[model samples]
Target: MRNLLILLVFFATSFGFSQELNCNVVVNAQLTGNENLQIYKTLEKQLTEFVNKTQWTKRKFKPQERIDCNIVINVTGQSGENFEASVQVQSSRPVFGSTYTTPVYNVNDKDFSFNYLEFQNLTYNENQYESNLISVLAFHINMVLGLDAESFSKEGGDPYFKQAQRIVNYSQQENFKGWKLEDGLQSKFALIDNILSPTFSDFRTVMYNYHRKGMDIMSTNDKDAKNEIALSLAYFRKMNANRPNSYLTRVFFDAKAEEIEQIFSSGPSVDVTTLIDLLNRVAPTHASKWRNIKF
Candidate 1:
């Protein structure tokens, strides 16, 4: 009996250790020429604060665990108009390592631009420069690190998207009128509304319905299947507005509702087969939840 007890203790310890996150991150920064050093410094400082303040899962990274990161500010012209900022981050998992790099442009008009890989025409107003950058960086890092990419994407991909959606959703509300800009304000709201309007809503509804139907088919007429499908269908119908025909939309929508119906119908429980199959269909080029999702 003592020997069996010792074996149990050992197994428990090993399992606990395996669940702990053991990874290192690093940050670095560099600037070119005699451009606005102050701007670059501010960017670096903000980026650092953003990462530190972010809750990267629970105990996934240690404060002392050397996060080697850098920012390079390059001045292509004598004037500051030709300035650009780039951020690169290196993160390691127990079984894999990855690198993510992104470049953000700050133009003379105080406008900003960044690439989202698939969609690149991202533009932000002068007043919202910092906020936009933070939103973009957070989205990029979350997507690359295999975090809740689907949730983030559904929530308009970042804070800016959510903010824009809110303004549109509550345009008739008393406070939203105050959100108007001094110039071309109508055009701005029009663009935002165009992206999140009825057509977009319909697309999301279709994806949600497809997913629910797939789940219903797989669940073998389980009583909870209907409720589970209803919940997921409702969520995506409200959330996904911009990504029509996206692989994320397809794979997630294609999942067997029956497989997930029980999990969603009951309390939280991991559905390993559903998750693995979804990841296999949408990993690498698109998004991945391999490290984060578990049974």
Candidate 2:
């Protein structure tokens, strides 16, 4: 009977592990223009590296995972000063015993220009330009989707469809002016507002207060205090879900919750100084709490 119970436990654990969604990604590039094919190849290589090298938290994915995705880049039009590119991203993931497939993103633009000389005539100074473009794109995607180190490290497990929705929403916004990109890098807050459905700033007040008084309350063994902190965390997470680039909130919640949980589990033996420091780190937004915190 004991052997059977252990075997069952092992099998259950293995089954649960196997059920985790896995993913792979393939990139397809098609360039149309008098431009050098080498340039397209370089772009392809850069993009591939970008996707592959990105770390998405702790959930790193293997190429042969159950989830699969593809990125198709079509350079459909080109003229001396006008260059057009279209990106169609497709993704598939298993959910609740069913496989869901969808277009993650379909964006086509004609005004963007890429100089072959940029790559071919590469100089140290020009490297910054390329880096800026890559950073902008990466930041945009990261904000549009709450991608962390775990998601980017995987192949198909990356949440591309959610990101697509953010892109669509941002594009439809009245304030969305393509001209803004011309002004150099946009503010992170603006990016968050643009891509997220709910404005992140809406929770700023609550989050700030939580950081101040909430942590101290959570340190107490009082059940009511713990529940209050939990409720606050839940609310913050929900609000963050409504906006792009709110992943930082998620991270903050995780860190704060873990600290609170540790204190609870350790009882009075836990280091109060450490807990205080953690609260202080998160208290910048809640000036009142910061001022009121005693020790």
Candidate 3:
């Protein structure tokens, strides 16, 4: 009750305009073994500022409300201004009452090839493609914001997702790997496209139910919360029956497998037998983590 009042008061009083994302951006060029680490450091600093400083949404957000996320650009090779890189994006949100924050979006996009010069200004234009660096970063940030919002309210992420889809649309025209349908099954195009497609609607439902219904209630009624979480996994079973191990499904389990194991392992006793079986079927890749579950 105290936390709720504090939050309500915060929202009511926080009329100040603030950045939407509290994100950490890292540029890891160690693999390249490049002597000129200055460029990579500069890239990291610029990206961190660009993402954290950009006002993603029109609504005002207090400091605590900023979405927590991270971006890591692994630079594998570089030649002149061109470079080969892979990007891993992760974002999470706080539970309603507890100090625990659940992972919401976790994805690593390979083939993030882009060109950059030292000290180049990074800017984002919603309607235009200035560069892959800007487009990819902005797209992920918006998607993170969208996912965070969806966890709180049903269909709350539509606008941000549409904006991300637009980013993909603009980026498809550019020379990039993760922005097109042909990039691979796990491409950024496939990620957002599958999410928005009615064929995979249950994915979004699981997002809402797993977070809002399940995790939020855990501190109050852990037993019921466990049941709610297990029920939420039923959406995955239905999605698997249709697509059978989809990219989006893999994406969910990628972020959630560890958390799922932890939740069901040492919490109030609940029948997760069906859940374990369903998980193995839908996300076989995480069989190892599922096996670690004692309960």
Candidate 4:
């Protein structure tokens, strides 16, 4: 198992319509024995540009309209040009009619092992594996866009999801660690697969409700917003029952747990006890966190 260190840094930059992600990329190799940090610094600069300047979607976005996400690469060891590391990816969007930003995706993947040459440009081709570093970064970027799209509209993320699946399919030819079918449940393969599966359609619907109907309306109508969120919880419970220990299911709650707890704890109209029982059933792994929600 690789040691993971997540350092989140936010970058606010003004850009014209083509850009879609306002991503912050950090490369930390303090734990590694190599004293020269210039290589890591170069990697960080290129990775940041790779994510932020890339025009990911056909639709245009203003500077402020871009999605916010963080990518942290923790270099654990190195043998010459080969670097062993893990990556933490997280993304969030602003809630409508409110100052709050809601987290939509979070994952710490430990299969990152790649070679880097200082000052080398990161290049990617959709149909080919240019580099393992670029492939992994591209895979997560598409997933972030896909999840953000699903939050706003029902199955609105289909195109992005399809693109991510394509990356997975083409990436199979590469001699990488995280792109294989049997890489376990929390693998990158399983995450995108679960999101695109018809059996997991209800989970997508709940995402729409949780963000659009619930978070978007919370400022103007707390009661109705809480009710909408509660209704979505039923769908979450249903998905959990149908597919136990789903990777997407775990991802969903990982992003929403703190927000959900705060909403119910602060909203007077919500039945905290009923929600406690429902949460326990659907997300038992988060039982300790749910215990903090009071009646």
Poorly placed runs, candidate 2 (over 4 Å): 1-36, 56-68, 76-84, 102-106, 109-111, 115-133, 143-194, 197-295
- For model 4, residues 1-295, the per-residue Cα lDDT tens digits are 1222222211223334388998999998878966467888889998998888877888878767889999999999988789999999999999988889999999898989998998887776776777888888889999999889989989999998888888888888878888888888888899998988888889888989989999899899988999898888888777777888788988888888888878877766667677789899888888887888875
RMSD in angstroms, candidate 1? 15.7
Q: In order, how many clashes per candidate? A: 20, 14, 0, 0
Q: Which candidate number has the best lDDT?
A: 3
lDDT of 2 by residue, 1-295 (tens): 9999999999776544432122232323344634455656676666655554444223434444433444555666655423355444333322122242212222222223333332432221211233323333443344223322222232221354244334434433333233244423233333344333345443434443343334434434445444444444444544534543343453344334434444345433422444444444443343334343332
**Ranking 1 against 3 by TM-score, winner:** 3
User: Can you write out model 3's per-residue Cα lDDT over 1-295, one digit (the tens) per residue?
Assistant: 9999999889765555478888888899989998367999888988888888877788888778988998999999999999889999999999988999999999898868899998998888888999988888888888898888889888888999999999999988877788988888888898889889898987778889999899999999989888888998988877888887789898889899999999999967888889999989998999998998778
Candidate 1 lDDT, tens digit per residue, 1-295? Answer: 9999999999776544312122222222233544445544554455455454454333333333323333232323323322233333333211112132111111111122321222223332322433334443443343333312212234322344445444333432322121234323223343344334554454334333433343323335433444444444444433334443443334333332323333443443434455444434433233333443343
Q: Which prediction has more favorable TM-score, 2 or 3?
A: 3
Report the Cα RMSD per candidate.
Answer: 15.7, 17.2, 5.9, 8.6
Q: Could you tell me which 10 consecutive residues in candidate 2 have the lowest summed lDDT?
A: 102-111
For candidate 1, the 10 contiguous residues with the lowest summed lDDT are 101-110
TM-score ranking from best candidate downward = 3, 4, 2, 1
What lDDT is reached at residue 91 by model 2? 39
